[model samples]
Target chain A: MNEPILRIRNIESFYGPIMAIRGVSLDVHPGQIVSILGANGAGKTTLMKTVSGVMDPEKGRITFDGQQIQGSEPHKVVQKGIVHVPEGREVFPLLTVDENLSLGAYTLSDKGQIDHDRDLVFSYFPVLKERRGQEAGTLSGGQQQMLAIGRGLMANPRIMLLDEPSLGLSPLLVQEIFGILKRLNDEQKMTMMLVEQNANAALELAHHGYVMEIGRIVMDGAADVLLQSEDIQNFYLGVQEEGARENRRWKRKKTWR
Target chain B: MDNAQLLISGLANGCVYGLIALGFVLIYKATEAVNFAQGDFMMLGAFVTIGLTNTEYMGLPFWLALPISLMIMGALGYLIDRLIIRRLFGESQTAVVILTIALGFVIRFAAGLIWGHEPQTLQNPLAGKEIRFGGLVLGMEDVAVIVVTILLTWGLYVFFSKTKLGLAMQGASQNQLAAYYMGIPVKRVQGFIWALAGVVAGIAGILFAAKGSVDPTTGLLGIKAFAAAVIGGFGSLPGALAGGLIVGVIEPFASRYVAAGYSQIAPYALLLAVLIFRPHGLFSQVRVKKV
Candidate 1:
């Protein structure tokens, strides 16, 4: 019951000469919200890209449902039921919202399944159904982000890799989106790997959380445990007690890699 | 200038340019490649029909020859994409642009070898036919051009805006990386676009040949068609046709009223004007993202 659905072992990825993600390992179990918390330049997006087969890892292995899938093409990875919702919500600006969602279901040949998936997406985000025919670019940033998420849901993916869902949104919108994500996880039992810089919002919603730094995972535990840890509060949660930073620096010596 | 007569004649010629511009826009949209060989594809389409319908050749009826010629041209476009364009996929677009420019010369030479350099016309049922309405006479060939262009425009519009595959293609064209993430086979969609461009080029050639004589050099008209595409915002579909009509109508009127030589340069002059005024061209505001 505890078996991980997606596993990565010491995967390395490069962009030309520079290594973007170096020797990273993580696991996402079924029907759980796994959050990777990091600041900018922490290789959070790179990890998502590598797992989705958008970037072929230079070394190590990625197994999804016990099958090696590290170097498969993006479309092939999608066919195996992993959908990547990219950073910056790159919905086709000129295309209608309906068109974008239909494209997300590109791997599905069953018309009935596609319709069902689209209906589910609309139900989750009723605003999407209202603006279905409108060009995606015309939508507000928050609406576009929902459209991006709804578009990803069109695939009926086994595990969805979400890159910064809270990015560039108002705090209220962030809470709204995370609430929907929590609902999706609980009601549909949808598994998700969420990468975020919004540690407070992400930690609140995630079942398990990992803190990443400079292309490596520095700390990981149950979301509540990580939230309560003194070192995490000082570093990620930005709690400032007298000499808390000094205490974190001292504690770093004992933290596991 | 006789306004009604010139308008009809101009519209007929405009339809041919519009059809050719349609090919340019179709290919350019799907793949960022600016195919300099589009005109030569047009030449090949006209020659294929001539070879089929002419008395000295296969002598197929015009109706039968039309579809057969379209299929042949479509196949040629697809093969060109699979063998040549696909090879140039990761290479700089300049490589493709140069290759297609060279292909234009090669295609023309091949057509000359097959059909000879002398001007040739299709043996068709529509030849020399005319329609008279309130003393406004129009060639049946001109009428056919207008009718066919409308039908093709409607058909392509429906295909692109309404169908799943078409929407996928439009998505792929706008952003390949995002498109790939959505499980679109971007490369395969591009190949289909080339095939479509070929079919469109064929239609333009058939209409042009029906209206007048064609030779190995007839492909030079592609420059005017290219100008039409520029005048229509390169990012938009409907803009392409409007651009073509503007160029086509300006041509005869420019010659009749302004001067004879002006007709040849009118489209280019208008193109320059559009570039100065609306840099993104008319209709569409989106600037095509450069690779």
Candidate 2:
């Protein structure tokens, strides 16, 4: 098999004294969309933070394009072409849409290329183009999410680490964004690691997927295989077998623990 | 007619106050800490210029001495940010505030030890020169003060809006972490901001010293400048200039129309009124933090 573009092996990270990610491992190959699915407190955000150099991993190795990048600063991580779209759409609220996108290309010296990429981002979300001069804070939740993603694209990232792109978005908006994500993957061959709680949407678009629970990956497989799995259907997809509805609560408690 | 003359004189003086207040506003925007030592920085600028111009010292011409002193003060400002202010960062706001107050004391005493307690006059090219417009007489120093303040303020406005480095500084001020994430060298940008503030302080000092005499305690005028900042809006630049003008005009008018005591209390009274009514100042935008 070809080498993965990004790899995390036996990585552990802590938030103060609390261990948020405990010896988790994952691989994202070139031109593949990898999704990590979990509930709240499942350490999905922590894993993304460690990869993007926002948080230091206490143990194990993180390599990007064959370079050790576990302890690098966030800015250095960007220079390596790995852009992180953090949870909650951290768009610079006061800056105009144009300025935010301009800042996203801050590391690049080529002004011409920066402008070209900005045009590309505008094509992906025409609304951002229309409101390009307005403050990002004035954007709606879904538009802000689009802006955040558009800002990431302005960096011309080789790979994107997206945390909860579907959060606080309507179902139709989620589908629209996911469609864009799929297009980026298919046409541009962009590698992405998407961490999300929206399992069905994420799994539907991802090439491969991992299920995390309590800072550990409990299951991982090809997206189609996981979607077809009875365990995934019953637990995550909310599909219960006939005559099994009465004992479902007791079964869930036993299975989760 | 008397009010018109007072207004002109007050505006000139207000320009000086506004210049000093700009330093406060700039540093506060960058670090969120009010550097009480900012006045002392201005004092140092004047002293450095005087020292360099003295025959026993460098004895350089006014033009030569000016840039040299400004560079020296800028470096001092950079060092202060790196060695002292940076260490106090992420600590409580009150702790940083008190540290700056202490810094002011240290700078004041250091100036006294170096230059002695007596006041010294600054040689200015425009000193003792005046232009007459009809019956009114304007001091060359007053005109210099107004001209220099306008130029400096305008220069700053251009720098913030037009330059890439200035835009980076603004980005850092708004959100340091986000700026860092965007691959901006935030630490270096912050150091540059401090150095730039220092350079501004030096220019203000020279202009101020040209008007009269300078001493170690000359830095104490920074208090009134602080009042100007509050009157304008703490974080706004144009507000600082406008605030300074208001304070400057009111003081001279109050002393002439009301009493000498009223001049002394005028700026503070206006400050209190503003705080009681429109706390955001005349030109400040009201920023709301989102959850």
Candidate 3:
């Protein structure tokens, strides 16, 4: 759709001998938030890692802006404008917040432009500006997540692959982070591919959603349709009164017997 | 030699050790792997200077020859990084260590073949001049060594703390993957560091040879430098210099008061004690990794 900005065709990834993702295919268009919803160990992180060039796919092609980039180095991938904010917020602990932000713009040649971006990032996450002199490790989970996002922004990426930005955060922080993500998508028109276990939040934010189970896509549709589907209601939301009533009847019959 | 004269000689030797140890610390910080060939690089630099000064091909003055040798050695370091060390990037720590050791042997043998086995003296402008302070006598050559070491150390402190490139190098040293993501050309920074380390080692070699003789066997001095690095804290820059000083001061004292052979063993013993007590060294900052 609309000349997919990133196209993943039949990607299979392995960790040594064990296959992590099998025949996984996905597409992301410009200026859209596409979410892959799955439980833990369902290849969500693996897919993100593969797309980011941290992990090499054994089979299939990854075409970014119509150019093959299946086995490129991670830094080269960043240069081509696909910045991955990896899971668990892997910020350099010892480096100051400002240093971390500066590192994010490592690829940009213009110092003036980088400084502008730095100011822009601080505006987006004002708390980072207040704590710019502090070591990154000293930041709380929510702040670290914000710093990670700000760092990604410094890269000036065309597309951002965010792997569970809300992980290990308080509910309040999660809401705030999601709000920022929405703002980034609407105001900046930033394209994002988000992998998250927060199914409800993910469905609410994503334009389109793919439901993954056991390393394969089980359901793919508009987020609203997926949210309203009987299958999803039964499996994820546990809204099956009919099944519960039948289970009680069966229990009664067994007791009588 | 009297106690005061021994102290002067010891401090002079310590300054040389400190300089070489500085190189070890710099390269190790940038690459996270000890370049075992560091000593051989110093040997090469000294011989390069000797060649330029002695041969009619260059006929350059000692001052000109020194910088030229440093440049040549720096180029050699850059080449080594491009041709060899870069290939070993992201390899296991053990593999990198072994690779550098192999590189050291190659450098040593190469220097031996090129410069021949004979020991040669580098002519110094103040070879015989000594300044006596009360009971203590200090040679002009020793003074040069102390001054140069102090200046270089100060320069390096400013470089790491105040400069952008230095900060980038420090960032790379601490977390290379993160540094790469930030847009630092990690490879280029590493190459620059290796070249810089070579220049430091070269300066140490010239200073050392100014006081004594230079030969292929001089590369073995790296072992003492390595000892200094271990004593300092493998990762600490200041620690390397202090470690060098300790080794320098202790060796002469041990030889005089203890036994002649004991001086050689003193550094190793100090290294062992440090490892057992403070594994990070006296000055190195502790780094904790998240699981």
Top TM-score: which candidate number? Answer: 1
User: What is candidate 3's lDDT per residue for A138-209, written digit by digit as tens?
Assistant: 888889899989999999899999989989888888889999999999988999999988777887888888
The whole-model lDDT of each prediction reads 0.89, 0.88, 0.84
**Candidate 3 Cα errors over 4 Å, as ranges:** A230-257, B1-11, B55-58, B89-91, B129-137, B161-164, B256-261
In candidate 3, clashing pairs total 3
Please give the range of 10 consecutive residues that has the lowest summed lDDT in model 1 chain A. Answer: A243-252
User: What TM-score would chain B receive for each of the candidates shown?
Assistant: 0.97, 0.96, 0.94
The residue pairs found clashing in candidate 3 are A103-B182, A106-B183, A107-B183
Docking class of 3: acceptable
Give lDDT tens digits, candidate 1, residues B1-291.
Answer: 288889888999998888888888888888888898898899899999999999899999889999999999989998999999999878998999999999999999999999999998877888899898887778999999999999999999999988888988899988788888888878888888899999999999998998899999999888888999899987577988888888999999999989999999888999999999998888765833211
**Candidate 2 per-residue lDDT over residues A52-103, each given as its tens digit:** 8878999999999999999788888999999988788878777788888888
Q: Give me the candidate number with maximum lDDT.
A: 1
Docking class of 1: medium
- Candidate numbers sorted by DockQ from highest down: 2, 1, 3
Instruction: Give candidate 2's root-mean-square deviation (CA, Å).
Output: 2.5
